[model samples]
Target: MRILIVHNLLWAHYKASVFQALQHLVDQQPDLSIRVLQIARNERSRASLETATDADTPTYTYQYELLFDRFLEDISLTERAQALLRHARAYKPDVINLTGYYDPAQLLLLAWAKLNGIRVVMQNESTAADHQRSGWKELFKRSVFRACDGFFCFGSQSADYLIQLGVPPAKILLRKNAVDNEALRAVYEQTLPNRTRLQQSLHLQTNNFVFVGRLIEVKNLPMLLNAFAEALKRSVNALNWGLILLGDGDQWAELSQQIGSLKLTDRVTLLPGRPWFRVPEVLALSNVLVLPSRSEPWGLVVNEAMVCGLPVIVSERCGCVQDLVHPDETGFVFDPEEPDKLTQLMVKFMDDLVDTQRMAYYAQQYIAPYAPDVVAQEMLDGFREITN
Candidate 1:
């Protein structure tokens, strides 16, 4: 069997880990082969998010191809479609797994696959809660979904959305997303000894609620600051607790101004986004991980934090919340729109009302099943089921 996966970025280390694991599985099967065609290096807006400074090459042990050395969005739609089609025709895969349905260039390849009787698998991270449903877009997506042989979703939320669109539940191959937990945990453990020195050098408090991601509007940075301020006002341990904002975006100046206006400059620190591997270094010095995105499909940061044994405070709207976060167990989930609710959860952490160590243990255990190897095996099994 020949399987070809169409992915967007070569610098997505998390995806690379899964691809590596999948390749390892395929190698064990003498009759199977898998290759990934990375569309671009990274998106323009997300250039800062990448740790690699070069043309975004794969560092893992896998058979893959880089179609372009630049961002795909910079390429013309016609050029992209032509390149994708050329690669698909040359490979003549028994099955083609699309990254998502958002890209029309990939959709053209999907259409061609259907006409040629090649099995198609669609991987979706978008949930109904991520955006407002459009009747026309729904109609178009239903047509697209109809051509696919199987589905791989981010979580239950995403899988349920496909079911609502009339897809049979049996067709949903995988409903969970994962990161390289063992790799991330190893990095975190290596950085553990230097946690004290790192925190002291940065002048960060020993116990802090850290938010790591793009400092954009959708991340709800303003609300995070406001909620942290409110929690400070209500906590006796306010002096010992702090907020760490990690990542760079266009909203830096505005977020800085808001921090000043809220009189939180001394308590809040904004750091530039670093590579995925270095995230464990940041998580080492922090006590809790917080993601307050107003609209997040699946917050993978939560998985990274959990792997490092740090409890998370994620938004209820995030797709990972239902599958990974257990309310008051692994961590707490608050409504992003409700500042007061977020403030209360923050206070619980600050006041030591929640058992951080206990919750952290639960977090690590809950995240074990969502490892890259598990997800890769599921993908392989799904391919076999469809092809046979």
Candidate 2:
């Protein structure tokens, strides 16, 4: 099979999941030819091309300065459409897979592919309720979807969403985001030594609960901070628990202020974002992983945390909650918007940290089947059936 995947690649960090899935496909089927046309972000203008592996897989990066300009959205769309069309003409892939949210460029590319007798697959993280919010973009998206052979979703909820959007039932494939299990396992095994070193360097306690991801509005950092504060105030042994906030975003200053206002400076610590490779170590060091996202399409980090054997507390709004989290069995699921409920869950986890570790063990066992290779195989099977 010759496949072409279309998606934006900003510094190659964003496409790790896709690369993992495709790499698995290449490894399993050596006859497969895969080409990626990565649309570089503005900051990657002078970025050097780096090969991910020694394999014969060819990745081509195209520089587009105006790909993310808000004022020149139409121009950017046209530019991306032209670039994809040029690549399609040259590569002529057997199947073209489109990932990410609905956009004009994606619609145009799908239309062009359909006109050229190419099989098209659209993969997105949105549910049906979310699709209705797209308004006019939904119409364009539907048009492109109608021309496609199949649709791929991250979970059953998303697959059901596409079905509700009137896509045929057989066309929806539920494939979760792929993770490198071996790499994760290796990281987990090596994390104890690294965690001790990091603890000594940062002077962090061993019982701290960690929250990662961007500190944005949808992430519900304020509610998390409030919840942590409330938990600390109510706990009989406040000194036994600590909080670590990882990653940085637009809400950093406000979140920092909230922590200070709540007098949680001693209990809660804010850490800057680290490289993707170091995330497993961070997860290993923490006693629990909290993802209080208000509206996350799919929380891949939740899977990563669970794979690292950390108990997770994710919001029901998170897509991964449906698949990865099983309240009391694997981890807990709380409402992201309900700070009080989040606080209660946090307090409950802190009170039962040993039980949480047992839950973390179950989480690792439960998520074993959804690893990268398994997901890639499922994807390949779907594509083969769709194209047949």
Candidate 3:
């Protein structure tokens, strides 16, 4: 059976890792063959995250075709659609996995596949809580969803959203997502010995809570800063802890102003974005990873943090909270709207009220099942189940 998977970005190291593993698995299974069509080289917003990955050193290697070797936004809808259709028609896949319903180009491909009697799978990541859903948009999504034969969701939250839209539970083929856990952990382990020196050289505190990603408004950085300031005020051992915002965004000036207003200029440090592979270096300097986004589809950074053996503090609205955070175990989850709730958890970390080491151990254990190779196996199985 031939499977053609349409992915939106070639910049996704994590997704590329999973595809690499899938390549190995498909090689072993003589009955299975697959090709991934990367829609674009990278999205403009994420280009900075891959700056350090040398072109010659392709750690993000997989058997894939690039439909557009440029930013997704720079490619017109007509160009994208024509390229996708041209390649897809030539490949003649028995089954096609679409990126998502939001992309008009992919939606057009879905329509073509339906007309051609090709099996189609919807790969979804959006959760119901990601944003306020309008009725018309939901209705439109339902229409597109009705055309797909199967679904592969990022997690239970995504699967639940599909069910809410009238999809049967049985149609949900795979409900998992993963990152390159082994590679991320390897970098963290290699940087472990110099963590203290690195922190000291950087003038960072002994313990730090890091927020890594774009400084976009949805990340709720102002609220995170407020909560961190409050936590520092309330914790007696606060002097030993600090906060790091390791990303650049449009909100840089605004966040910087807020940091000054909250009198946390010294307690909080703003760092620029780095290549995803180098994220473990920041993880090494941090005691915990904090994702205070008001709405997150699935916080993959939590997976990265857990893989690096650091506990996470995520907002309840994050889809990954349900699967990754285990209150007082792997980490804690709080309502983003409740600044006091977030502050209390931050205090617990600083006051020695939480067992950091134990939580770190459990975090790694909890993420083990979501490793790339494991998820690849599940994806391969899902493809076989659908095609046969």
Candidate 4:
């Protein structure tokens, strides 16, 4: 089978699970010939063109003059339609998989694939209406769904949403996002012995919890910070616990100001975003992982943290919370907006008397089935069904 992957690739940062799954599929199936075509704006042309490919894989890239200053004006329909038509003719792929949010390129590719009798698989972070509010945008997005052969959603909610958008239920595949288990295992094996040393180096006490993701309003960081502060105040051993925040975003200044006003500067540490490769090391050094997002399509990082053998506390709003977390089994789920609820879960998680090693063991066991290889095989099976 010859497959082509069309998606946006910026800064050579393809840490997304979909990309990892595609790469894993290519590596495992000898009979599958895979190629990736990255679409970038004119400004990213130099960097995108200069990217080097691994010698072991068959890959190619194409760049065009699509440019826009803001998110809403990124690409015009005609330009994207033309690009999709050109790339489809040039690559002549048997199966085309498109990943990303709703965009002109995605819609055009789906329509062109339908016209050409090519198998089209559309994978998005989540449902269209869940992310966008405009009526026109929802209508446009529904049209895009009509053109694809199959739809792959990162969670069951997303699949249900697609069905609500008029997509046939049978055409939607519910495949949870996964982790690169091999990379995670390698990093864990190398860093497991240095956990205590790394924690000490960072000045984190044994009870510190870690939060990783862009520090933004949608992530509900302010609520989380408040809940953490409340939890610390309620605990008798408040002096021993702290919170470590990873990643930066537009909400940094506001969050910093709130933390300062609340006198939480000493209890919270803000770390800048690290490369994707170093994330496992960071996860291993932390005692627990917390994701408090107001609305999350699927929290891929939750899966990654669980695979790294770290207990997680995610909000019920996050789609991945249902698939990855089994309340009090592998991790706990709370309402992100409710500080009291989150604080209660945090307090319970911290006070649990069970062996930490056993908790980590359970976390690993729960997440192992969603490894990249297994997810990729499922994706391949979906593609086969679509193509046949």
Question: Model 2 has how many clashing residue pairs?
Answer: 0
Q: Which digits, one per residue and each the tens of the lDDT, describe model 4 over residues 1-388?
A: 7787775543334234545566666767787766666555223322222334454222323232222332223556776567666867887888888875466667667667778878888886674323655678668778777877887778776787778788898897545667666666677668879878887887767677889888777898988889998988777667877788988677889889988988988878888776555677777767789998878888878877887888888888787866788876788888765789988877775665435677789888988878755776777788778877
- Ranked candidates (lDDT, high to low): 1, 3, 2, 4
Model 1 per-residue lDDT at 176: 86
Better of 2 and 3 by TM-score: 3
Write candidate 1's Cα lDDT for 233-260 as tens digits: 9998999999999899989999999999
Q: What is the lDDT of residue 33 in candidate 4?
A: 68
**Reference-based lDDT, residue 218, model 2:** 79
TM-scores of all candidate predictions against the true structure: 0.97, 0.86, 0.97, 0.84
The clash count for each model shown is 0, 0, 0, 0
Give the lDDT of residue 62 in candidate 4. 29
RMSD of each: 1.8, 4.7, 1.4, 4.8
Among all windows of 10 consecutive residues in model 2, the one with the lowest summed lDDT is 57-66
lDDT of 1 at 208: 93
Q: How accurate is candidate 4 locally (lDDT)?
A: 0.72
As for lDDT, the candidate ahead, 1 or 3, is: 1
Instruction: State the displacement of the C-alpha of residue 213, model 3, in Å, after optimal TM-score superposition.
Output: 0.8
